[model samples]
Each structure stands twice: as C-alpha cells, then as structure tokens.
Target chain A: MTRPAPLAAGISAAAAAGRRAPVLHAEALQLRFGAVAALRDVSLSVAENEIHAIIGPNGAGKSSLLNCLSGFYRPQSGRVYFDGEDITQLRPHRRAAAGLGRTFQGIQTYPSMTARENILTGFHNRMRTGVFGALVWWGRVRAEEEAFTAKAEEIIEFLELEELRHAVVGDLSYGLRKRVDLGRAMALEPRILIMDEPMAGMNPEEKGDLARFILDIRDANRIPVVLVEHDMEVVMDISDTVTVLDFGEVIAVGTPREVRENEAVIAAYLGTE
Target chain B: MLPTGVLFETYSAEAGLLKTARARVAVAALVLALLAAPLATGAYLQGVATHMFITLIAVYGLHVTVGMAGQINIAQSAFVGVGAFATARLSEFGLPFFIVVPVAALVTGAVSVVFALPAARVKGFYLALTTFAAQVLFPIIVLGLPTSWLGGLVGLAVEPLTVAGRPMNTPTHMYYFTLALTLIASYAAFNLHRSRFGRALKAVRDNDVAAEVMGIDVLRHKIMAFFVGSMFAGVAGSCMAWVLQFVTVESFTLFTSVWYLGMLIVGGAYSPIGAILGVAFITLVQEGLHELGTAILRSGAQEAGGAIFAATNIALGACILIALIFEPRGLAHRWQVLKTGLQLWPFPHR
Candidate 1:
C-alpha cells in the first residue's frame, strides 16, 4: 500500500465501525507506589474501534493508567471491566489471554529469536499441544505448528519482513525492532491493542509507514487501539479521542481539535510545572 | 541454515532436518556410517564413541535448560545420578531395560522438579545456586544413607542390559544400545525446541514480562524446561549405568556438571547438533591429552607423571577459556558463518 495522506479530520474508528460501545472501561482507578501516587482516580473508556490516545508530560501517569488497564498494576481502589467482565484482580497474562495485547516502549521482542520466530511466539498461548505432544511432534502437534507458522508468515508479510524473516531480531535496527514488536502484538489477535510510544525513535518515513499500519489496524482489523504517544503529529492525525493527563489525573477528553483548543491542556503542555 | 539455492513449498518441508536431496543422501550416509561403526572401529574407539553418544544425550538436556531456555542448571549430573541409581534399583527388581529407562527418566525428571521449583522466582546466578544445592545434596544423600539401601561408598553394581533373555556383556552390544537411545533423545530434544513449548520457553528466556503479556505462563515454561532437560539426563544416566554396570556418587560430580556447561559453550547451545559436536570436541580433547600424558610418561620424557597430568588439566581449562574468548557462540555457529561466507564467496555476508 502507498503511504496514505495524513487524515484531514478526527475520523474516529467509531465512524468506520458504524457504532459506538465502550469495550474497555477503567473506573476510578487510584494507584500509589509507597508515598507517591502514580495514578489518582484515573478513569478512561476505550470504545469499540476507537483509537484513544493518552497524552501527558513526564510523571503524568500515562503509563500508570495503561499498566492498570492491562493488569500490570492493580489500582488501590477501582476495577477494570473488559467486555462487561471485571478483570481487576486478573494477572497480566490472563488479561492478555482475555484479548488485551500490548507493546512495550522498551521493545520486548525476543532478541535471540528470528523475526518470524518472535512473531510465532505470540501465538504460543493459542496452541493446545503440550510438551509431550510437542516432543513427539506427531500429526496433531505438527499440524498445529504449521498452522501457527502460516499465521506468523502473514504478519511477516504484512510488516514487509520477508527479507529479514530469518534474521535475529537483536541484530535489527531500533525502528525495525519496534515494528516487529507491533507485529507480535498484532498476532495476539487482541480485542484491544495498547501501545506505548510506537513511534518514539522512527524517522519520518518509518513514522509514516507506522501511521498507515495503525490506520489499517483500526480500519481493516476494526480493533480498538489505546496508544500512549508523545508525537503530537501522530496524535492529531490518527487518534479519534485525545485524553490529556496532568499530575496523575485526566485534564481533558475530546476530539483532537477540541483537545488542542482546551485551555487546561495548553497550560499543561506549555505552562508552569 | 540452508544452502542459498534451497527453498521449501510447505512449512513441514521448510522445518525439516534434511531439506535438500543432497541433505537426504548425506544424512543416510551418516546413518549407515553410525550403524557400521562397531564393525570398522577397534573396541577402544567403539567404547569411546558409545560414551560420546551418552554424553551427547545429557548435553542435549543442558542445551534445553541453559542454552535455549536460559535457565542455568548446575546440578545436571545429579539428575543423571538419580537416573543411574533408579536404573540400578529397577534392574535388580527384574525389569527390562526398556521399562527401566522410561521409569528412571520419569523419576529423575521428578527429582529435577524439586530443585527447579525455585526457578519460577529466581533466575541467572540465583537459579544456578538453587541447582547447586541439588548437586551438593545428591552425594550426601547417597553416602549418608544406609550401606544396604544405596550401597553407600561401595556403590551399587547394575546388571548388564539383557536383550532377548541374554545378558549384553560385550562393549559392542553397549554401543548399539546407547546409539539407539541417543538418536531418540536427540530427536525428542530437537522437536521440543521447534514446538509451542519451545517457543514459550524461548519467549520467557528472552523477555519474560513480554512473554507474560503475550499470554505465556512464564513460571510453567521454565519448570517444563527443567523437567524435560532432566529427563534427557535421566535417559543418559540409564544408558551410563548399563554401560559401566555400576552406580556410584563418584561418577556424577559438580565437575561433570561444569564440564557439561563447557561442552555446550564449545559446541553451540542453540541446536541439538551443536550439543553433540560439543560433547565430541570436549571428549576428544580430554582423551587425546590423557593419551599424550601417558605416552610421555611411558617414553620417560617426564620424570614424573603427576606434573604432565596437572598440566593437562590446566590445558583443558585454557582451551575452554580460549574458546569463550574467540568463538563464543560455539563451534556450530562458527561453522554456519563459514558456510554462509563460502556461499557468498568474496562478497560480505552479514
């Protein structure tokens, strides 16, 4: 696909999905680490097919909220409901199994594994073959593995990683590693894809590619995306709703244009600490 | 790694050990050579080759835990000992070696899980220390027990493996027995790494938190790696018991475990073939040095044998240190790089 032009208006994924329903809900989440509060009464809703962007300055609890929502951090008081079920006490892997996939800002792709193998690891939980079955590598396990590899191949093709499919991921450039991380997350077939700084270090060309991929995920896959990005250009172009955070609290929630015009968001971005 | 011209139409064909027509012929030739080893080689060389097969089996276990899964195990020999002793006891009960092998493997796997329980929480040096406890305690428990039960320091003599109601007394018979198990164990280890469990274990080894986010139970995979690795050790131990016709704490030591780690580093930790190559390299070097020391003493080149023997130990240590400094990824990886370079010819291939 050619690089798509920047979106002119805030085209919410809701518009493409043709309906709106809160698929992921975080209500009154309050998290504290000893004395300092990382998040205080942070509440957010990710509607179906919406690209919800969480923007904040440093120490503004953007990651803290994502952690709580993804079940990495438990809130002191409150719950996270996913698809109408309370998942507050569930573990991170359980939450992931429940269809919440995420990419780490630090790039958590398996370094020693190949680009294709790293993507295949994402489908690990989906396979029913146990260790004994795998050791045997009989018909059932062999079929399961072939099926998973076929799926990984699709992701590899989608990310244009055909040439680098056998290359060790640790040897890949930072931009490529981030892209592989996105592919692995995508392989999880998540109901809600959460990404932290998906374009932190990419050049403009790579950023455009990533932007198009994110749009494809929203438009083609129709999965809701909750992204924490510092790149304002990306936030304004793709995100349907921009939730601005300041001092561990939500300051504004609106369309990108309205968020840009909010007095409180402007003050937090360019005003006193 | 594949030759540049080779390609596959299916995942099964792609993942196959022998992908090309030439590879198939080469593997068949290798199999014929192995099967004909007893006929061509002298008794001593055949014995050495058989021992190599057994060591390769245990090293494959180490490859899984320390190499692939990145879980350090310093008590591999203890698991081997568990198998050996289990086999010695089972054989006395009039069980066949076939039944004895799997039972010993299961017992050893269970024993390894006892030490591996801490692996769920601890990693790296701490995990090694936990396994170290198993290494230290294995001998103590064997020697500390009653002389009649575990045979104490006197050790327990295992009956020679019997085939079709006949005792397998000859070294050639032992060689065939071991080669068969080694092939099966190697096949199992190879398949384990390519399976879903292998992917889960590798994911945990690489970035466990990310693995968890990918919906893998990190603790379960780590424990499974230990269970499977130790079971390989068990099968090796059973073969060892039948070969030596004995079980003794002196045979399985911390040094043996350390040497297994060294062999893994020397060969290449990633592939099962690497594990075999590592065992071959280390065993040949040690045996070759030992023969040289004995020959020098016999030729009266050295006033005393003790000095040359000590030097041999130093030289062995030096070889491992040099290998780490130079080919850190192991011989198998260096071989791949060489092949890839040859395929590229004069041009750089990264």
Candidate 2:
C-alpha cells in the first residue's frame, strides 16, 4: 500500500501507481572525512520515471549522499546497487560507464569548448573509439562521429541551445552555462540522472526553463531524476518522492506534502519556531 | 565557415573540413604549389623547406600535448631525440624508412609515457617540472648506455634512405620524402582534433573534474595526449635522421624543444594549420634574417650595415613577442578572424 498522490496533479510520473523495481539505490551508506561524518547510514532508492528529490538545509550531507550514490565517494560501510547489481567499489568514470550520469553543483562545463562539443563529450562512455581509431578517422570512425554529433545536436535542440552551439561555454552567461551542463548530462543518455543543485543560482525565467527541460527529460526520455535541490518551490513542483536530510542522516521520506508537514523537517528548517 | 547566407541541413555538412568552395580551391592550390615548388626551387631552398617540414611535425606534437591536452611538454625535443636514436638503431637492421618511421614513433611514444606517468598526475608548473625531468634524464641515459650501442659521445651515421634499392641522397629526394610524411602527420593531427579523442583531451584540459564526471578518464586521456604527441615528434625525428643521413642527440636538445613549443604558440596550438603557419613563419624569419646578416657583412656599407643587421637580429628575436602582443591567440587565430571577416563581408565587426 502507498500514500495517496494528493499533490501529484502536474507531471506524468505516477506516485507509486505502477512502481517498478528500483533502478538505483544506496543501502546503509556511512561516509566519513576524518572525524567528521558526512553521511551516516543514509539509504534511498529511485525507481524508473520517478523524480526523486533530496532536500536539506546547508551542511546536511545531501552532496555526500549524492557522491556516495554516484561512485565519487566510497562509503566506509555500504553498497550502491543499480539494476539489482551492487556497484559500491566502482570509480566515478566506471559508474558512468554503467549508466550513472551526474551534473555538479556549479557550472562544471568544458570552458574552452563550444556548447555542442561539450555535449558531444558527454557521449564519452557510449562510444567505443580509441586514440588510434580516432586519429586515423576511417569510415567507421567518421560514421561514429557523425552519429554522435547528431545526438549532441538533438540535446542542443531540446535545450534550445541552437544559437549557443558554436559559442565557447566560458563566454556564455552563468545561466546558459548551467543549462549547457544539463544538456551535457542529458547527452550521456543515463538511465538515472543525478543532478547536484541544478538550479543553485538562476533567474526566475532560466529556472522555469530548466524545470521544463527536466520534466521533458523524464516524460520523453523515461530517465528517473535524483535531484538535490535547495529550492523548495521547484522541488515540490517536480518531485514525486521527497527525502529530507539533516546533519548526515535521513530525517523524513514521503510525498512532497507529507514531508513538508513532517515535524522533524519543520524543526530542521525552522528550529522550534 | 559557409557563405554569408548559406545553411546546411545536416551536421556532417556543417562540420566538414573544407566547408566552402574557396577553402577547397585554396587547399588544392596549396597542394599543387607544394608539389610543384620542389621542381622550380634551388637545392638550398629545398633543403630549408625539408627542415621546416621536420619542425612542423614536431610542433604538431607540441600542439596536441600543450595545446589540445593542456599538458605542458618542454621535453618534446627529448622525445624527438629518442625517436631519432630509435630510428638509427632500427635502420641498422636494414628495414626501409617506411617500417622504421612508424616503429620509431611507437618507441618514442612509449618513452614519453614513462614521463607522462608522473606528468599526468600533476598540473601546470609541476607537470612542466615532470617533463623537464625527462629532458634532464635523456642525455644522461643516452650517454650512460654502452658506447657500442648508439655511440655515446659519437653519434650514429647510418645508411642512406633507399627507394627501389637505390640510395635517395639528393636534396629533392629528401624534400619530397619529408614532405609526404609531414602531410600524413599533419592529417593525423588534424583528425585527432576533429574526433572524439580530441574532445576528450580538451575536456580534460579545460576541467578534469568535469571531464571525469562526463565519463572521460582524465588521466588516461592526458597520457594519451603525451603518447600521441611524442609519436608525431618521433616521426619528425625519423624524417630528420633520414634527411641528414645521421642521428645526433645534440640535434634535439632542450633548447630545440623550447623552440618547438615556441612554434606551436606562434602558429596557435589548437589547430593543425596553426602548427604549419607557426613553424613556417618562424623558420622563414630566422633563415631570411641569417641570409641578410651574411649579405650585410660582405656589403659596401659594412659598419652601418653590420650595426643595422645586429639591430635586425634583436628585432627578429623579438618578432615572436611582437606577434603575441598583436595577436595573443597566434597567427592561426588571426587567420580565422580574417576568414570570418571574409564570410561576414560588408560588415567589419562580428
């Protein structure tokens, strides 16, 4: 039995209407940096087509949880499972190869590269061309490159980045660069997309555009999104399942309205007010 | 760039190497002229052109390592020396220059990886020091090897290059051979920039953390840049050895490596054409000024001419700085700007 979707009036991702097996999950993760515990026994699961949102106050271990799940940080005692396979020991790029796509908290794009080239690099794990093969550029290599270029263009088209295709990302506005970062992650064609504060600093219009793109990605691409966001409005508007974290531990997990009313989450945010 | 009003429906057409009729015609003309110049030029000019070809290939390697991959390689000339020594030893086995060149490149590339192993882990000044260690070790290792191996103090003067069982020792022969290989090396470097390897390399260069999160193995791509860059230098070394009919460690010193980097900077590092333009521009300036100095020393106005020529030497030495001052991106970037102006004619600003 699942909670009612009283707030699921917007997006198409059902709130447990037809939930499948979890596509990505972190089980009992415990990460420590020296004496400080960044995450302790944190666990969460994301199913297909679900927009799973992780919301927390600053210093609440949201990044640590995302890092542990994305293979950037190894939990001292836990396991990460994707498609029912444990991938705890995998490195970041290795996990990426296994379809773990991620976007950083800031504008972490290839500054010197054009917007399109930046997105094309997101297809790194998908393609199989090596140094020699790429250097030689035979028929097969050219074909592979053209196909990647087309795929990258598709991402650019969806992001409405046709004009910025040739512009170097470093020269673009901050909002545009953030959008390019998202487009690049989309270019990975990840089964489950993990975004770290995809809208940390943005104008209202850019935030609306990115939110729309996120919904389009879920509806059209069928990729589940695990978003670590500070914006409560955007989180409540998009997320199907909400997990509230505080001080390196999960405090509450439920639907948006349920977590919004949860006494612990209220205390964590407002502190006995 | 396409014509002002032109548009392409396909990405392939938009990304074509020669997108315009003018570029195609220019490439054809340049090829025809290069093939025809050897016939019309004197032996001295041919010899100088052959030398420029060697420098071009070396600079191409630097462009990849320093330019695209953002790996600082001041010891590229050391890698070139490794290639030369390797080619000399390979030639003693009586293989043709064709088989020998590729093998020498691989040997040099592998040698570069030894340094790249440490270099790849570091960045900026530390990486420079790592490559510098390669340069510092090159002469010591070469000299420390048995005198019987590749001639410690004394260099190797192997057999001349052969084609159809005949020694091709003429300047024209050397020029044509170096020209062909230089073109091939250029093509390979160009293709590297166009394809996925280059994108990955640039990604690592611009931001390694971002690159890693994007599924690129940053360390591997950095090492790959060094390996491929050294291979180009190795091919250049092979060309240098066969053309000069000798191999000497002195020919590829740290000073020479610095010059190769200088050429890459002058040409612009990001593109293959920049390598060519940079190498040719610097070579012409140096050679032309040398010829003028020699002429002035023998002229009627000896004292004044000598003073003027000495000033000219300082000016010529400062030309690279001057070029950088005017066009910080290098001559290739200036060329791009000019072409963009051509594409956007009737409007001076872009």
Candidate 3:
C-alpha cells in the first residue's frame, strides 16, 4: 500500500528518534480450550503511532488473540511485552494501569450507568485518592475527579457524543454504544489502544464516521492502535500494516495492498467461502 | 442556551445522598419518630416492640449476607446461639452488659467465619446445606456437652442490665435500649452499602466474573460480609438474652434461622427498610396468632385452639411460597416502586 505522505514523514521522524522497540509485542502465543487449539504460534507487533490491522476469515482466533492481550485469557505458552516490559502474567486491571487499553467486540457497558459514568469506571485505576478521601470529599480528591471529568468531556466532544453524555448506555443504539465503549477505553489514556471489531455491526455511514474518529484519535494522542476487524475497505484505508490469520496461524503480514494480493490470503478466504 | 435547570438536575444526580430532597426529609422524620416511640407506647407494647427491635438487628445481618452478598445462610441462628450463650456465661461472672454484648458479637462473628469456609467452594443448595449443618450442630453440641457455662439443656439465667446504677428491668427501659442499638446497627448497615467495600460486595453479588475482572477479591469480600452479618446477629442474640434474663439452646434453634430467612425474603433482601419491615411483619403475625389461640381457648374451643396452634406453621409456609411466587424481589422493592410513583406522581416512567 502507498503510505499517506504525512504518515510516512511521521514514521521516518519516529524511526530517526530511535523508536525501534515495539510498544506491544506478542510471540508464539498459544491457547487451548479442551480439544480445540484456539490459537497457535500467533505472533504480532505494534509500532508507535501506527494503525495495525488483523483481518481473517471466520474462526481465525482474532478475538482469542485480543483476549490474551487484554488479560482475559492466559495462553498455554507465550509472552506479551508492553512498553518494553514483560507483562505476560499481569492481571487485566494491572495491564490497564501499565497503559494498555482495550475495547470488547460485544458492548460491555454498565447498563445502570450513564455514558459519562461508564467512562469514569475506566478511570478507576488512574484515580489515586483513597476511600477516606472520597468519603470526606477532600480538596485534592475533588480536584483530581474534576480533572478527570474534564478530560472525559474532551473525549466525549471529540467523539461527538456530548448529546448522549448523560444518557444511560442501555438506552443507546448499537453504534452509539460502540462509540461509548471506545470513549471508555480512551478514558484510561493508554499509550496503546486495542479495538476488537469497532465497526462490526455499524452501517456504512457509521463505519465512515468511526474510521474518521480512529484516525483523529491516532493523530491527536499519538497512540498506536491494534485493530481486529473484518471490514476490508476500512483495513485498506486506515491501516499502515495488515496481518492475515488463518486458523490461529499468521498466513501473511505486509502493507494492506500486499496482503490483499497474497495467494495464501486469497486461498484461505476462498476455501472458507 | 445557558444552563439553569439543567445544572440543577445534574447537581442533584451527582449529589449521591439518598435520591431526592423528600427522601432526605422522610428519613429524618423516621429517625425522630423512632426516638419518640418509647414515650408514646404502653409497657406491654414496649416489650413486644423491644423484641421486634432485637429481631430487626438479626434480620439486618442476614440482609448483608443473602441480600447484598448473594449468599444463602441458614446458620445465622447458630451464631445467635453462640452469642446468647457467651453473654449468659459472661453475665454469670458479673460482667457488665456493655462488655458482654461486644464480646459476644466478636465471638459470634468469628464462629460465622468458620461456617463461611464451605461458602468459598460451594454455592446455592450446597452452601445452604453447609450452614444447615452448622445450625443443627449448634444445638447438639450445646445440649450434649456437660458444660456448666452453657447450663446444658436448661440454660443459664442472666443478670439484669443496668445503666448508671439504675436497673433496666422494666419493659420501657429495655425498649429504648433495644431501639437505640437497632438504630445504630441499621445506620451502620446502610452506610456500608454506600462505601467502597459495600459496592464491591454488591458487584460480587451481581456478577462475580465481572467483579473479579474489575480486580475485586471476590472471596475476601464474601467472607468479610459473612463476618459483618454474623456480628450483627450476635448483637441481637446478646440483647435477647439480656432482655429475657435467660439463655437456652431451644431459644436459638434451627427454626429461628429459617424464620430469619423468611423475614429477609418477605421484607425485601437489599433494603434496610425491608429488614425492619420484615421483622415487624413476622413478629406481629406471630403475636397475633398467639393472641388468637388464647382467645379460642378462653371461648371453650380447646380442641380447635390446639389445631389452630398446630396449623400456624402451615400458614407461614404458605405465605412464604406465595410471596416468593408473586413478589420475588420482596416488600422493599414494592415500597421503592410506591415511593418512586409518588415522587414522580402523574408520570408513569420508573
């Protein structure tokens, strides 16, 4: 794929600054559920400020890979490195604290909470005030909460979700819920963001809007994104690199155009269809 | 447009103290009324009310376990038994009532932790069975063991409690004492629900997987809840022993645990109001049945009176079944629905 001129400039500048170490790296990750090996020998790396996409046919273990990275599943054998630290055995919230944020394919919004409150739950780890401080409504805790609230509001405005800030997540549409889920992950202010099928159930218009938002997030925060999505058009448009998986194995890895033309990628999709 | 009423509404939502201004006022008024109940009621009613107050403390403990923590316990009466026996034994040595009560509560809380061990590994019917075993074992161990402290099958007599050299042997004094303790216990339980630990417990109850994912230690919270709940039960047991001036194995039977569980279901498991309401309703019903039996016997229907007394359990069983089927959420939920309806009067949205 032909890289965008500005993105190529940014990449070369980062490379010049000695940004060779991957922000997140997974090596030979394997997971087994009973008789089925959900993932086998899966390896991937995400560079700083780049949009990396993982795409495959159905049952390619895309979700399983995301789960392992997010600390939901412990692989039988593998190591995950985040920010140059080995975080293979860290718990989910600990990983989140270490600047790793993730959103689920299925919406996991707390139904009883408003959009703003749901996002605030993501900021739980960042808030340093103890229980006593919260109970007394001390000055420092109030200031801290106010600061986080302002940040969350900025994220809401960026996502164009200000109108739905006070609305309960249960009452929102699927597309809106997806955006709210993204807002929640953003509240964590992670250095690396992992999105699992952000456009899975959105219409074409919604998909375009989310794609623009994703790009804006990358530009504004300079945070690398690891996206697992099936939308080929989106993958081609936004991704700096694309990896194709087939039955838990990485079959192809290159620029979007290169993967699109690979014989192995074509064969994997053809056999499934 | 600049924000005016919008800011006010947002402020109210963010306040997180009760839900509305009216609720604040209502809670304040209720507290005042409870403080004045002893002055208004007669002696016999005061005694009955004091008993109700004690039972409410026990019910509140069960509420923490079954309602908030989502753990079924049929062993609360066993903890009560431990507390009651502990109090009696201590009082026999001439220990003050205040000293005995707290000591009993702690001992019972510790015993509850023992019963809660199986809860870490089992749930639902299996957990209930473990508690049931504890309930049965309490009576057998107390009665079978030839211990002078427990007084064997007959039990021990308690010394009358006194405040500032004035003995509280009268029903009216005991009523105020029990009522004050009940208020403190209720306040503590309600405040806990709003605390971080309380929210963690509720999170564990609502969804253990999600709570664990959120980094809450589910096992630790569950066990802590059991300890707190049993501590409350211990207070009730100690108070009951003091009020009656006696302690016996029969008083803290397995049947008491079953009745406490029934009270939790009838009153509504999650609400503190439900705990008090359930206790009041169950106590009043039992008293009413006893009165009816007396009236029947006095009217020369001795045989029918015997049958009516025998059938009381059947009636209570039927009420529990019906309440479970029709109002599974309990009376507390019904009360909330009513309150919300009144607050948002002329608008039907909940």
- Candidate that would win on DockQ: 1
Ranking by TM-score: 1, 2, 3
Number of clashing pairs per prediction, in order: 0, 0, 0
Docking class of 3: incorrect
- Off-target runs (Cα >4 Å) in candidate 3 are A1-20, A49-52, A91-102, A105-227, A233-241, A254-258, B1-21, B85-106, B140-160, B164-166, B347-350
Global lDDT scores for all candidate models: 0.86, 0.86, 0.79
Give the Cα-based TM-score of candidate 2 against the true structure.
0.93
Question: Docking quality tier of candidate 2?
Answer: medium
TM-score winner among the candidates?
1
Distance from true position, residue B75, model 1, in Å?
0.4
Runs in model 1 deviating more than 4 A are A1-19, B146-148, B302-305, B346-350
- A82-196 per-residue lDDT for model 2 (tens digits): 8777889887888888888888898789998899999999998888888888778888887888898989988989999998899989999999999899988888889999999
Kindly list the per-residue Cα lDDT of model 2 for residues B51-138, writing each as its tens digit: 9998898899999999999899999899989888888898899998779999999999999999999889999999999999999898
lDDT of 1 at B19: 76
Q: Write the per-residue lDDT of candidate 1 for residues B1-350, one digit (tens) a residue.
A: 67667977889768776677886898789878999988888889889988899889999999999887889998898899999999999999989888999999999999988888886579777888899999999999999999988799999999879988998888899899898998889789888878888888888888999998889988888888899999999999999999999899999999999989989988988888789878998898888878877988898878566577877768778767887899888888877877688767787863
Worst 10 residues of 3 chain B by lDDT: B1-10
Candidates' RMSD to native: 5.1, 4.2, 5.7
